[model samples]
Target: MESDKIIESILNDFNSFNIDDIPNIDLYMDQVTTYLNNKFEGSKRNDDDKLLTKTMINNYAKSRLLPPPEKKKYSKDHLILLMMIFYLKNIISINDIDTALSPLIKDYFNDGNNSLEEIFKLFIQYMKDTDDNQSIIDAYVKSNEYFSNLDNEDNKEYLQTLTLIATLTYECLSRKMIIEKLIDSLPKEENSKDKSDKNKSDKNKTDK
Candidate 1:
């Protein structure tokens, strides 16, 4: 499919789970994977495009991107965290994901007030209000059109690919800069101190 057509189709059918849409019951590893796959079915380009794998889940836990599951079952909060990591990892490093999500996990992991699910819902709604998908489609369409006009028929595909790459580069970098600023603005005494303590603990374990 042409890039513009693909973008239009994806935007037209863009769908994500609302807070209420997520399963409330604690799910085992396989179930969690299946649920996430189902939620992302519309976005997948092919059957091989798996959203979550057992190895990935284990790696997330090992890297502290996800809190450890209880008795091999993932709670609603864990699922939400995984969902956040899925999207953020596409544009940022795991370290950045840790920095961005640490405070939220600390404050609201299992607590009823200001829960992760609630925050996720708010973010989804905010994205919807901002018409982010439309913005993406417009950007892709504009870039594609701009590149199409150049008199290089032989290099048209290459130029179109470059245009998409340029668009993605700008979008990723712009968003990353804002995210870095936000991370820097977080309360240093709390987050920084916690990070230092964790590092010390890890080093001690390594030395042991």
Candidate 2:
């Protein structure tokens, strides 16, 4: 059997989460583990992990990454950071997770509670600038192209979103919706080349 040692080592980092920050696993580990296992596997080793020593825990309060506790008491926040490390090392290609986490950390510090809006917005910005999201989209499209089964065509959500876009599009062209805002929501000109492409969606909801 292939050893699960590497996987355990990577996961072992998350187990050191401060008990104070995360009261219980039920309170916090919602998407963190899912994000972790989705990114890290038992096998692949990239050059990046060379420096990502097991002696680390994400200390968001101090705005720093430091050595893990001796006994390894896990918390939800720490696990979230572990999930981020997995993404930085494997999925998303940014030099470090500390910088990648800064914006989210900044926003949470400002509000005392993290906002999903700011988090995803930062993610979108990163993906757009760093080719992360685009690569994921491309990979998904490629996967769909090759997979034998994917014909469960549900255009309801697609059509509804499209309807909203059409409404916005019609209004924009007719001088009702703001062109600048509509442009922000519209698909990129190059990406929108295939006008008939069903999967490509443009979303723009304007004030009526």
Candidate 3:
């Protein structure tokens, strides 16, 4: 019953925050950090933990995982990218993030057929559509059902917790593998060719 209540609470909070909530105005670095910290406060393990900091933002910029701010101010698009990067960094290495996001950044940063907001909105929708909340609840229920006949309550509880942890870990690992494969499947040379073509087009326009 406690687990059910906790799970329901988590599920209820899931969609409380959305990408549309990000501010449209360009923000200074301090403003960006404050906004992120406030927006992702629920993600923090403790009150003292900050979700984002100036130093982390600077490192991300230096790593080129984030596009440089215009006149030292970050746009809405920048915030979208940072939000993605924040979630991604927990699962994958920074280098992998750069590799995976290269195409997205090239096509949608600042200017593109689809705005970054639209793309991110679609992504969130897809996730929401695909996630099965019932499956999670079922897993928790099954964990409790297991080892029900065991005489030792302490051992039963420990095993049940371990079972739940293992289940979640396996699911995370499976998804991580899929992400790695998707990153590998991304076009490596096409990005360079596209850049070259754009450069040539600009040159021709300038000449004319």
Candidate 4:
């Protein structure tokens, strides 16, 4: 009665889902820390460095978003979501990041939500359609449930960064899903060999 099982069954029944859509989550997450370090390259953003400032952390919590590890700490599991955020910042409303992050945060990065995979699938579709659209700013802005608590102009940059970080959170989630689906698509040598041998033996038996 697992949720993915239910979804897989439905996809199989309707022929809308393919083996290509399944994901290998564990392998993808394992590489996140290293990938993040490369983004910083020579910069020293250690995992223990507490990349998120106190205000940033509070903003994420209030907006129900997540901040990634800075220098040393990083989570590959969250990489896809981070990438999506980066994509959004350039094309969509730079102010509504907290809204995009809500889905991942609420679903625990889509780890085990009953509808996690479906939501991820939806988000991917959304990205594909709107990732580069001009109305992206409006659509994204209207999508937010967060009414900012800020009244000071000095906090604009802080808010913008928070939004950017939230978008990153989303990128991590989406990228992770894509990676998992790609991994799941790989054929298993053992299973393929077993099936091939069985077919050969059955052919021999029929010939006899």
lDDT of each: 0.80, 0.40, 0.84, 0.46
| lDDT per residue as tens, model 3, 59-153 | 88876678889999999999999999998998988877888888888899988576988999998898788877777888888999987888998
Give the local distance difference test score of model 4. Answer: 0.46
Q: Give TM-scores for every candidate, taking all chains together and pairing residue i with residue i.
A: 0.77, 0.29, 0.82, 0.29
Q: Write the per-residue lDDT of candidate 4 for residues 1-208, one digit (tens) a residue.
A: 2323433453343333222333344323235434433443323335555322345333433333454444433343344455455445444443344444544554566366454445556766764556343333433343332434557644644564456457656866786667556545654233333656889999999999
**Error of model 4, residue 22, in angstroms:** 11
**C-alpha-based local distance difference test score of model 3:** 0.84
Pairs in steric clash, model 1? none
Candidate 3, pairs of clashing residues: none
Ranking by TM-score: 3, 1, 4, 2
Q: Where is model 3 poorest over a 10-residue stretch in terms of lDDT?
A: 187-196
Worst 10 residues of 4 by lDDT: 14-23
Candidate 1 lDDT tens digits, 1-208 = 3777766667665544466878899999999999988877767878889778999999988766688899999999998998888888877787777888887888889887777777888898887798877667677667667768778775776777677778878888998899888877876534444766889999999999
